[model samples]
Target: MELYKWSAQATGLGCYAYFCWCCFLGSLAEDINESKTSCCCISNILAVYRMKVRATLKIRGDSFSDACVVCWCPFCAGLQMRNELRNRGLA
Candidate 1:
């Protein structure tokens, strides 16, 4: 289960799940580079640079508006992702 309810928003119709806007954008760019590099880019923008939450949410670039959401909102989406990566020693 996902910790952040807002993290998995429905992209299209029929309740299909899509990542949050920032992550969604990053995932779209996943094909252009190495997976590790891509993850690094996103993570750097969301967590390391701004309000580091319990879980880090990475985006292809720094989307400050969304970052603020992750930072201020108690139900932060980034915290969930950050923990998963950290548990695996990936973050």
Candidate 2:
């Protein structure tokens, strides 16, 4: 009778250990899935932000070039020169 009781207790302990291991594995899988999802979200957001910054920089560069062209033109250069002279009280 004592031997049977010992065997039953050992079986119960084995089942409990297996159950705990399965729970730990399940939790680990969930954590990995969450990490992957978070990484994807962050990457997508960065991609969008990068595209917007590129577009804004392109527009700003184009505007600056246009202004430079206007300022360097003979017709517009005189106006700018006069404005500079006036600011220096030389006009």
Candidate 3:
């Protein structure tokens, strides 16, 4: 009877250890997912900011603006240029 009791206790401890390991792994996965999500959010924000800054510079005839002109989506940039021109009384 004593032997049986010891075997049962050992089995229970093994199961407990397994459960703890699984929980730890699950938490690690969540942390990785959160990090990836935050990175994507930051990348999107930077892209939008770059677009706005490019538009502003293009409208102002800044030399650095000539590096790349995304003519495919010209409306935003053109509007920016027009607005700047109007603001400067050059329109």
Q: Write candidate 2's Cα lDDT for 3-90 as tens digits.
A: 1110111122233334553342233224223232332333232233223322423322233443453345422322232233334443
lDDT of 3 by residue, 1-91 (tens): 1111101111222333345533422332242232323323332432343344335334233323422332333223333333333344443
List, in order, the clash count of every candidate structure.
5, 0, 0
**After aligning candidate 1 to the native by TM-score, how far in Å is the CA of 25 from where it should be?**
26
TM for candidate 1 is 0.24
Top model by TM-score, which number?
A: 3
Clashes of 1: 5
Tens digit of lDDT per residue, candidate 1, span 1-91?
A: 2343223332231211133544543532342222433444553454433333322434233457556654664133444444333444544
What's the TM-score of every candidate structure?
Answer: 0.24, 0.22, 0.26
Model 1 scores a C-alpha lDDT of 0.38
Error of 1 at 80 (Å): 2.5
Q: In lDDT terms, how accurate is model 3?
A: 0.32
Tell me how far candidate 1 lies from the true structure as C-alpha RMSD in angstroms: 13.8
* Best-matching candidate per lDDT: 1
Off by over 4 Å in 1: 1-58, 72-75, 84-91
Models ranked on TM-score: 3, 1, 2
List candidate 2 stretches off by more than 4 Å.
Answer: 1-72
